[model samples]
Structures are given as structure tokens and as C-alpha cells.
Target chain A: MTLQMTVSPDFPPAYIAGWYIFNTWLQRQSGLPIHLTLYDSFAAQRAVLAQGGIDLIYANPYDAAFLVRECGFVTLAAPCNRADEVVLAGTQTGPVNTIEDLAAGTVIARTDDPDVNLMGMMLLEPAALHAGNTTAITVDSYPLVAKQLLQGHAGIGFFLEEAFDSLSALVRGQLRELVRSRISVIRHVLLAGPGVRAQQVEHLTTLLLAMDQDDRGQAVLESMNLSGWEAHSQEDTEFMIDLMDTLDTQVLPG
Target chain B: MDGYQTRIRYFDGHSRDALIREHEVPFPDGRLIVSRTDTCGIITHCNQAFVEMSGYPERELIGQPHSILRHPDMPRAAFQDLWETVQAGRKWHGHVKNLRKDGSCYWVLATVIPNVRHGRIAGYTSVRRKPARSRIHESIALYARLREAENP
Candidate 1:
């Protein structure tokens, strides 16, 4: 069967072509037939996943836990030194300067990115804001989240730290960072499903680890805004998953 | 005939109104009505029990928003809590009143969980089973108050 590969939908949209290039390179190196599918939303991607249509995936931290625990997927690699973090921001001209300044009824613009939204909500706990007390407006992408804040449609916004940093300087300048999660252990991971043979997983892991040393691999990495790939041990994966579960339980309903 | 026509209105392409039979479809014991939806609440899959309980064929349920089965009497805040809990990757349990295609309704104790793929939430799976009639009565009264508060 032709192996199906997909990346988490939360990746920066500009790097979409980069993922395709990477997929092509992997197929060539492994001498295996691989098809790359891009999904517009988490729900759309998940529809296919429910049917067991995916074999290889670049997953976000939240999904990683599920794939590991429920789907029996094994970690292949993770982006080197790239931890997923969330930034809570507001318009520079907005009255809320800190989390403490936020109050009930604050309109929060965000994407469906689960982990980022979870962290953003946690940051607001200090000020007693939550899903019940505050209103949440979901947008399609991080840029749209910024647009909502800039247009005064929302009082604050939740963003993936990488997405926040990649915003154009003009837009970035108008936004003031209220806070950012400092959790460094959580990061996106590449995983191979249970159907992938052990030999194939080992071969792919080796190829990924060597990508930074070659010119073509370096170019692909640069396109994807990745420094390199590092092997993620099962223990490390379990630890992160546990941390995520712990965090999930700590969030109390408003 | 004119008065009867006035009692019928449309909902989800089916005519429903105050005069539509208000009755219960008692959930089958020892069976679960299972359905899956994408993160956006679009139904992706449903089991035979769900189809039977909902009075909707598999074709009608799939690809439709889960809200297609939402009874008008169900309070909005209850769903809000469900969404908030599942979006955070947590499980939620509650009693829900679900409308069937024929305009009848059923009560179930429902549990919903977010399905994760590659470290991100992809969809949700909801498994519902028979709820005690006493518990259903409690929900009925509680939801009535909640609906009143919401509308007021």
C-alpha cells in the first residue's frame, strides 16, 4: 500500500510547499511510494484519520499524546530545539496591559490550535478569565487572530509563538505581548504508525538525523524553517505526554 | 386542516412544531449510540444504534453538523460546556436531549472525547447510553431553567 503522510494543520501556511518537497525527498531516499496530503482544518484531517488513512504524520504535542496512547504510533523525530509555546497578546492601544488587567467579557480571538489555546487559557487564570466568563472568537489562522485584534473585534488573541513571531513587522508592532508560556518540553513530533515496519522506521530515523549534514537536506530544512531533526526517545515522548495530561487536568472550568 | 398546517414548521428540512408528537425513544439497554465528528462538530461517522435512536439514516447523519439532532429545548450553555471541555482535550459527560428525524426525541447519558492525531485534536467521539428516567427528569427541569435564563 502507498504510505500516507500528513503534517499537523497548525503549521505556517507559507511552508506548505516545503512539506511537499520534504515528502518527495523522503520517497526518493527510501525508494517507497508516499503520498502527501494537506488538510485545511483539524476536523477535515481528523475525518481521514478516523478511517485509518494515515501512516506517517508530523504531529503537534496534543495529537502526539493521542497517537502514542491510542493509535500505537511510534515517534520518529522532532524538530531540533523547537519547542511549541503560546503567546497571549493584545493590541498595543488596548487597555489590558497584563493578565491581571483582563476582566469578564473580554473577547479572545484564537485558532483551533488546542495546546496553544489551553496554555492561553491557563495564562488568563491569574485574572480569573475563562471560557464561561470571557467570550472566544475562533479564526482560521494566526494572522487572522492578529487581524481580529488589530480591527478591535477582539480584546486579546492567542497564537502559536512561532506564528506570532512570523507575523509581519507592521502587524507585530501594533500588538503587545501580554504573556507567553515558557514550557520548553512540549514540541511537535514526527511519528510512524503501527503499520510501518520496524526496519522502515529505523531507516527513516537515520535519514532524518543525517539531513542537516547534506546540502539538499539543508535546503529543505531551511524552507521549512527547521534547523534539523533529532531522534525522540520513547521515554521523552511519554514524559511530554504525561506533562500534557497533567496540564489538561489542572484547567478548571469557569 | 389550516390549523394543522400552522402547527407544522420546518427544521433540518423536516417539518416540526409545537404540535409534533412530544414523546421519548427510550435508549436500548446494554447498547451504546456512538458517533464521531470532526473538531468543527461535523458528523463523520455514526453507528447503527445512533441511526436507530436518531431516526436518521447513516447518509443523513454523516457530513451534517451534529446540531442537526439538537432539540430546540436543549439549552445552549450545556453545549458550550461540552465544547469547552472537549476542546481542551478532556472528556465530558452529561445528559442530552436529542431530536430524531421524525421530530421525536431521546435522552441519553453522553460522553465525548477529542480524538487526537499526530499530537493535535482531529475530531471527537461521543458514546451515549441509556440514562435513568429519574436523571432525565432532573435534566429536564435543570435545562428548562437554564433555557429560561439564557433567553431572559
Candidate 2:
């Protein structure tokens, strides 16, 4: 009967705007009872969702993977409203052309949000991702790092797309994209549980997808880039579950 | 009329409530603090006892999380284990260090239970009592170092 949604702190304001529009659409359209709760990280949200305390959750692919498979959650669909990734250069240096092109001890300032997209990028070159090394500075927000970089604190910076969009104009202008990532499918997924029936679940999805095509839904879709909802498969949900299982096992040095 | 009283915060509001609201378990020094959290460790409430024990006024505790009381003396495994057990709808009993309003500290022997609804967790509930000397000594020694590291 309740809908619990969890989203990242990165680009949260944008999604808040998107929700006001989208939730209003739902209020007018099918009268489906839906609500949202936002968070700063995927790990924190995933833990709460796993307790089976929530009815539905809006999670990233990485977190969703674990919730649907390892926990008792089931994925309904994935959304493509906000998606972009970029490697931002510091003011004193140019962006690296590739992960391999960076100097062995190249300094890269990072902002680590609570999701895997950025962490996944770091995994692409883990050795290059030490947190405390003089060459690597990990912060919680991109603009902070961008500010530090612009002030000549760090040599270079990496900004995932959402953060890249909101950086100060000064930081944005001073920095150039060293490289851009392929548009990754970062979805805001809706996952459900055993209490929800198939018919009720489909009704919610159909109403949501059809909303965009309608005049009211169209407005929300435009603002949020919420194209439509498609059925999610077990495959789409497995990767995160496997990763969480790995993280869980490796949590302590037992 | 101005006799000294054990001050506590109401879970739902800012007004101070008396510790007369009896709990299933009686705490030493009448210092019983109760909290609610969904199985994930998010806090839902902190009774008047919690405010008195924490030295934080109700305004500071309302809508804040339960782990807001997390003391460094506690091992990471304890929290990890607490999450695992409560999410499984089990109750946990242990010792804890609670930070006071002015950044001083106190100790507690605590029990935490999951709020189960329809065979699932709705939230978690916790009860605390004054910690024994043995528990306090170990935790305080551990926390002294933690606070030092955090401050230094």
C-alpha cells in the first residue's frame, strides 16, 4: 500500500523537481498510492530495503541487482531520466585521454556518491583509486572537488555527468572533458515485494508509462526524461546481488 | 514545585514528558530511553528517557536517526551484527556509549527488538538500562581513544 523510493544525493535536487511533476501526474491519472524517500547513498538505502521494511524502492542498477535477487525484492522497470558520465579536468591540468593515459602517480580528485556507477569507474582502474594518497583525493561532492581542483589543490578531477552539470560555471569553463563515457543506462528502478499482486503491479506500470504520452504525463516526462517502463528480468537484477554477496563476505578481515 | 526531575523527550513532539510512562523493563536511575527504527537501523523515536540520557533536548532528537548515538567504542561488527539480527526480526542485547548534550558520555545496557508486521519488519524498538561497571570500563577506555583520534 506504501511506496518507498531511495535515490542518491548526487543530482538529488533535479530528481526532486522530477518527482514533484511525476507524482502530481500519478495523483491525477490512476490515483495509484505511491510515495518516495530519498537518500545519499545506494548502500544505506539498500540496507533498509533489505530489511523488508519497504513496499517499493527506487534504486540504482547496482543496488537493485542485490535487492531483487538476494533480498526479497522484485524489479518492475528501469528509468532513464538522468544519465551522464564525464572525466573533468582540473584547472592546472588537462583531462586524461583514457584511464591508461594518466601518469602513474597522477593526482585525481574524486567525489564518491553512494552508488556503483562512479565506484565502477574506479574499479576499471583500482590501483589508480587510492583514497588518501597525495595523488588521489576522495570527497563526497564533485563541486567541492572541482573547487579544490580549480584552486590548484588537485591535478585533475573526474565528474560523473550529474555532478558535471551542476559545477560552478567557473569550474566548468576552466575544466575540459578529458574523456566522456558512453551513455550508461543508469535507471531509477521500481522494485516490489510478495504482498503486491501481478495485476496491481502491472496497473501501476501501465499508468506510469502511458502518462508520458498524455498531456499531463508528457510534461513530467519531458522534465524527468522518464520515457517508459519495461518489464525487468532476473538477469538485470543479478549483478548487484552478486556484488553485495561479495561485499558482505569480504566485509570483515575474518 | 521545582523538585529535580528526570527530563525526557517525547518521541512525537518537543514538550518534555515525565518518566512516569512505565516501560516493560525498569531502568536503573530511571534512565530508560526507547527508540523506533525500521529494521535497517533508521530511528523512529527517542522517549523522554533518551533525551535525558543523551542530554540533547527533544528538538535535537526528533527526526534524527538512532545511530546518532553511535559511540566509537562500539566495534563495527557489533553494528553489522545488530543490523543483521534486527532485520531478521530478532532482539539484540548489548552495551553502548551514549554521547551527552555537552559532548560528555554515559553508558547503557541495551536491548533492541524488531517491530514485526505481517511477518515482516515495520520498525525496530530499543530499551536501555545503566551499564554495569565491567561493561562501562571497557567501553569508556575504548571510547577515550576514539574521541582522541576524532578530535586530534
Candidate 3:
């Protein structure tokens, strides 16, 4: 079966390269071929997966929810995510470290798609002041969010940790850490199409988990930031149902 | 377009195909594509992946100008600068935006080098692959913006 699927283009070559290495390891272990069709964003991937273009996917945590519920896919494995997710904020003076320090009516900046970004924040629990308090400004890109922050147009920028280092470092220094989300990222996830043989996925994921125990396997795992795999699909059922309940999207013309 | 007749080799004067097969990029996942030609533009050889990604039957590309895939939106100055750099026999690495046969665009992290061997200038060789998302987003958007400005 074609393992082709969509993935977030956020991380770049490192993210794609990691998949290449993992795919190679899996093939050597299971003797099966896997291919991927990567897209620029989770939103883009989700649209295609919904139409049945992908048999497997490498998705983020919140994105994984959409695929599970909306597309009827099953999650097989979660890769190691970065320790930090990301925060969006503009210039701030003095020490405003806690989430409580921020006042109401503060506008937290975000992208056009709230399904991934906002849902992730909900999972992480932003400052209560953020509830019914903050207004969201629709921006097209992260750089625009950065622009809003630099121009003092936005109060906070909620984004991924992989922001351009210059602005990322500045935010870390200048803004209050209103919400330091643990970024329960699914640095990588192994997924399968709806109604895929459970045993096939189970067998491959079992090989992925076993890689942590041996030496050569550890080399590939370490180079790839594999912290070992965990099984959690049944647990994801409710979130999946909830995700489809809320998010509506269209496929991007490729 | 007997660009191949104008032979020059930048490194060790080998044909483009030979260099590609042997040049193990230091980055294990890194890939390269090279070809030989004269000081003028003409294609002699191409690496395996080059043919695959360009989506062109190999024969269609070998005798054509490298600019065949130059999207109408690419900056002429980028090409001009690239030519200038390779002519100086210095290697340059940067991101490039190219169009596929079907007109879909993909960004490549590209490196271009001039062929210089035995005190004579030969042709040029380029290596490229899909770039990181951050770089792809920044580079493609910026290049297109620059191209529009140049045309305007």
C-alpha cells in the first residue's frame, strides 16, 4: 500500500529528513516500502487527507485530532516534540512573568487558522485573562505576526518554538511568559487511513518502539530525536470527535 | 548549442555525471546534481534525481538552456549574480525557486559552481534539493517579490 500522506512544512529539511531516516529504519525492520507526500501546512494536509489522498500522515498534536475525527484515520505512534511550543507577544517592559499579570482586553495575535493554534492553546491552558478577554487579529503568516509584534500592533504572538531565532529570542527576553505550554507536540506521528488493518499498523509501530533497545537502532533514533513511541489512539477518540465537531476546511489547490 | 564542445571542468575537470555519483555530500541526507558543458550554456549530462524532479524526459533538457525552468517570476538579477559568481570560479549556495513541468513551483536549496581546471574556465554545475520550510517560505516569497519589482 502507498504510505503517501501530508505533513506540516513548519520544520523544513530537518523534519523531512527525519521522516526519511525513520522510513528507512522501518523498511529495514519490516521490509515494507513507505512513501510520503508532504504539504506546507497542517491545514493543507488535513484537506487532502479528508479527500482520501493519504494512506498515512505525519501530523502535529492538534492536527492529529483533525485527521482522527474528520478524516477517520487512526493514530499509531507519537514522535518526540520540542520541549517548548511557542508564544506570540509584542513588546513589553518590566517583569511580566506570570499569566495573571496581563490585563483584560489584551489582543493575542494568531494566524488565520485557529483550529490548530487555538486548540493547542486550549490544551495548554492560557491565562484566564485570555478567556472572553482577548481579541484575535487575523494575519497571513508568522512573519506578519512578528511584524505586528515589532510594530506594537499586537499584544502577544502565539506561535511555534521554531520562529526565526532573532524574534524568538527577543520575545523570550521582552514579553511575559503568560503561558508556557509544554508543547505536547507530536514531533512526528505514524498514522494510517480509515479501516487500515490494525495488525499492520501495530506490527510496524512495534518495530519503531523496539528500535530504542538496540545499538544501531539507537544511532538512527538519536539522530532523529526519537524518545521512543507511545500507544494512545483509544485515548484520542473523544478529542477526535470534538475536532470534527468544530473545524471546517477546504483543500488547497496544488 | 554545442555547449558541451566548450568543455571546462571546475574541479578535477571531470564530466558532471561522474562528480555527482562520487560526491558524497557531507550531510548524509544531502543530495547533488551536476552536468558538464562549455563556457557557454549547453547541457551534456544530468544526475538521476535531476531528471526525476524536473519531470522532463532527460532528452528534453540536455540541449536546452538551464533557464528552461526559470519561472517567469524569478529575478533576472539572481541569475545574473549567479552567473557572475560561477564565472569567478567561486562556489555559492542559496535557495532557488523553480517551476516543474506541470507548472507547480518548489523551492530548492541550491549551490552553483563554475568549472575551472588547468587554468581554463569550463562550464558550470548546479546542485539543488527541497529546502527547509522556513527557508522555503522566506526565499520563495522574497524572490517573487524581487522578480516583480525587477519587471516593474
Give the number of colliding residue pairs in candidate 3: 9
Candidate 2 accuracy as TM-score = 0.50
Better candidate by TM-score, 1 or 3 = 1
C-alpha local distance difference test of each model: 0.81, 0.55, 0.55
Error of 2 at B46 (Å): 55
Which stretch of 10 consecutive residues in model 2 chain A shows the poorest summed lDDT?
A: A245-254
Estimate, for each residue in A56-88, the C-alpha lDDT of model 1 and write its tens digit.
999988888888888889999999999888888
Instruction: List, in the given order, the native-contact fraction of each candidate.
Output: 0.00, 0.00, 0.00
Instruction: Tell me the docking grade of candidate 2.
Output: incorrect
Question: Chain B TM-score in candidate 1, rounded to 2 decimals?
Answer: 0.86
lDDT of 1 by residue, B118-149 (tens): 68887887867555555677789999999899
Model 3 agreement with the true structure over A1-254: per-residue lDDT tens digits:
65564555554345567666766777678766666566765567767766777876655555665666567677776654442255544455533444434555766666644433643334222233334556777676666676676667766666655553434565456554444333232234567777457787788778866777888777777665566666555434332332222212111111
In model 3, which regions exceed 4 Å deviation? Answer: A11-13, A80-88, A94-105, A112-116, A119-135, A138-144, A161-171, A182-188, A236-254, B1-152
Output the lDDT of residue A118, model 2: 44
Query: Where is model 2 more than 4 Å wrong at Cα?
Result: A27-30, A40-47, A80-88, A92-101, A104-107, A114-136, A166-168, A183-186, A237-254, B1-152
Residues B71-145, candidate 3, lDDT per residue (tens digit)?
A: 544566777777777688776566666655645445565666565443556566565533344555566688778
Worst 10 residues of 3 chain A by lDDT: A245-254
lDDT by residue (tens digit), candidate 2, A141-249:
7777787777766666777666686776866887766544432334446777666677767776677655656676677776765676555564444423322222221
